[model samples]
Target: MDTWWLLAIPVIFGLGWIARGFDLKELLSESARLPRSYFNGLNFLLNEQPDRAIEAFIEVVKLDPETIELHFALGNLFRRRGEMERAIRLHRNLLERADLPVEFRDQALFALAQDYLRAGLLDRAESAFKSLADTPHADQAAGFLAEVYQLQSEWQLSIDALQRSGADTPAKSRTIAHLYCELAEAAIEHKDLKAARERLAQARAADAALLRIVQIEISIAAAEQAWARIVELADQTLAEHPEFAPQVVEAYIDAAQHVAFSAPGQRPLDTQLRSWFDASPNDALAAVIIKRLEAAGSMSAALEFARVALQRLPRLSQAHALLRLRAAMQGDGDEDLAHITQMMNGMLRSQKRHECRNCGFRAQRFFWQCPGCKQWDTLPYAASPVGP
Candidate 1:
């Protein structure tokens, strides 16, 4: 029995050696079967030369028409390089193949849709995205569809697409509310106040506490001459969201003045302005209050306010305000003050730019939506406390 066991072990070893030899030969044959361009493409890709790699891969695809994944890769490369027409053609060719796998067909369709989107063919892109419904790419398709609708200014369609996207998040809610706000603004433009109110109601329902909702409501009330409602909203904004005080201050003062004219006993504009400044002290608010006093012919009050503002914040803007106030009170013969004020004004112009909170894009005027990132409610007041 021992002799038989020794002979069986050598036999097993011999068979194993022969099997390994066959595997080695098979690997070598497969390596030889791949064209040289395939290796060249891989080398170029590894070296990060995408343009040369694309040419090499194109040769490989021509030599081997059945290389499905290479076609997809080439299509993606073309699209990324802004060659949308080439990508569209390649993906369309892939979809035309009767023997293509179901998964590859879906991928080809999605790729074609993206090509159309990037090419600015909105109608074709919308149709293609709609066709992807119930497929694995449906969620992504819905998002792209909404973007298309947004670019086209089809607010209702965009809202509908966003709802179908099923991404229930705070950002999505805000985007929907902004869409409703867009509709509201349009309604207001056409003098359809009733429709504007309805759209604003929908916007509030989407985001009950959005600051922009209150702002739009103020606008609607102003249009309707509802002075009392405007005053209330302005107060609510200042008390509840003090961080946005700068943007709302002018509107609040305007509404307050209107209310005071009608009722004759509403809080004085100067008092309300001073109260807001005390809560959220900034050079802009101080400037507004000073202007109000000057408008009322209270030169003494304006000079005092400007002096107090300069003491609190020793910025060039405050100095300029004080210089102007003193000149106005003392009969305007101070050439040095005028020259200094002019120099400060030149410097302040550059600093008085509103910046986007999301992307840091600066603009001379305020924007609800950032022009850089297309984000809504991103621009805060100018970083400087005082500017035109």
Candidate 2:
């Protein structure tokens, strides 16, 4: 037998003794009948007949009103079955008894808090959990409080509660970064660029490996028309995480454009564009290079650049760029355009925009958190094939 059963034997005998002293002969007799009903309820539970088992346990509670164990079991069962109302009623009744032991009372309060939490009565749940803050249940209550704060989108409160409970392990730091990112996004929405920048700094401090924070910072700098800052951040990001080169190409182009426009005689845009393209052969980057070449009155050079890129990435976008350049010279032809468009459509059909590597969830747009599994920084950018 388990050591808990050995410990419980003395409590059972004491309850029987107390019942006899109170001249509660019926209660004393009912104590003797407990084993049979308790075993029957266990059998029913093992058989997966939860309704029948709960009925048996309910009868046992009625007969032996002082049996705290039976009440706890029934309350837990109701909660497991999604019967929050019944679980709350049973736990509340146990809490009301003046004669109940302190341990049992604490257990009842914990159970009642769970009931309120499941019912979405967060205020009542918080109050009930607060009462257990000094008890053995404190750690568990604090963890639940963190979860409640997360649901309410109160990231700071959630972080505080998690720290108090010591539940914020190393693996949770990535999640902390995401929370800071969310705050940064909110600040951006409110047009508070300074606060948004501060939050992004905090996010990077929390988890230096978080590439999304760098991306967001670059975007904010671009929005503020801080061309130098944008270029600096984009360069740092690419140097740190080169695999995100494709995604950062557009920002880099925009930053270069801003610089070129700001200082016309400093350095030609083509020089910087050619240098980056030589360093990284990204389709998006190649596209930007072609556009820049065309803008500089060099359509023939742009065609040559597109052809060189096509050798590496035979995607529809590159092919379309080539076709448009050719048509601009030789006049429009539906056959060539139609063929390239069909190939592009075919490539897109096999592509997934984003996928959550943690949970295998696929979606069209990027999500910092997975909606299916609620994990932070789990989604990965998926590459689609280009056609010519």
Candidate 3:
């Protein structure tokens, strides 16, 4: 029986050795399709040694040229790491392969376009995206085209590209309007009033509710010295779009004063100004009133004007207009005037008048479109954008 047990022990160990040999054979066969460098690359990647991993992976790709997935992974890794030249080369090589599947061909083309764009090869990128026009990537390609055209200041091309893109919605109406307005603004800069007018008309057609058209129209009228027309247009537009009340009011006040001061024995525009202030006691309108009162040497009236403004707006352009007004009323003279002038300058310097409601991008001046997000009408009217 002891001898029988010793024989059984040898048989069990032999069976275990045979099983291990079979397992090792299977592992060797499976790993034979992948080079040893592939395992080294994976180990280096696991250790976060990307430079070494890349070198090892390149060795693997060279050893096994049919490693399609490995190529794609490595190519994308290069692109994300800002190695555009390598990404471009790898994707181009993939595209050159006639045996590549249709799906892979399209993916390679898109990746190639991205590589070109990242490298600032805009013309090449444009050509690549144009080739993708009729494919499933058409809409995405169109969006990139819009961005490219806008960046290049090709307003008409940008507008056409946006029209082709599937991103058009009621929400993007102001963006379309701005595209048209940009053309109008360009025309005006080039002294082409007729073309400017036409473009402005198109801008309004894109979004009838835009305040930009009114501002442009006022500017055009100013160029023609049509102060009366400027006032008329400002009033008409302000009636429908009261959100631009501050700007329209300022324009009207300026135009009215220009016409009033140009002619002799003409009544001052104070009546019109006072009437507007009575209807809408905005801080800007009140400020205008105080200026007129101070111009006429009425300190009491100017103090009263500032007091009334403070009731509606506690801080004028986020400055303590009320406290300053009280101090001026207490002091009351050239000292007060100098102090007030300094305060006004401070307010001007501190104020961020326009802000992108979409992206919270603040600006000292107004933008029809946000510089941060490139969206139109996102900059709302506010003297103090970042603060109450």
The models' CA-based lDDT, in order, is 0.84, 0.77, 0.77
- The candidate 2 region of ten consecutive residues with least summed lDDT is 379-388
The TM-scores, one per candidate, come to 0.74, 0.60, 0.66
- How displaced is residue 220 in candidate 3, in Å? 2.1
| 12: Cα error in model 2, Å | 30
How many steric overlaps does candidate 2 have?
4
Q: Choose 1 or 3, whichever is better by lDDT.
A: 1
Query: What TM-score does candidate 1 get on C-alpha atoms?
Result: 0.74
Colliding pairs, model 1: none
Which candidate should be chosen as best, given TM-score against the real structure? 1
Cα lDDT of model 3 by residue, 257-342, tens digit? 66644455433567656656666555566667777787788888777767766666665442455455556666655575657657
How many clashes does the backbone of model 3 have? 0
Q: Whole-model lDDT for model 3 versus the true structure?
A: 0.77
Best by lDDT: 1
The sequence of per-residue lDDT tens digits that candidate 2 reaches over residues 1-388 is: 5588888999999998997788787777766766677778989999999999999898878877877887888999999999999999999999999998898889899999999988889889878888888998988888778667777789887666666775556656777777778888888888899999888888888787888887788778877888888777766666555556666777777777667444544445566556666666655567778887888789899889889877776766677677767766665556776566566657665665567888887775567778766677677643445333
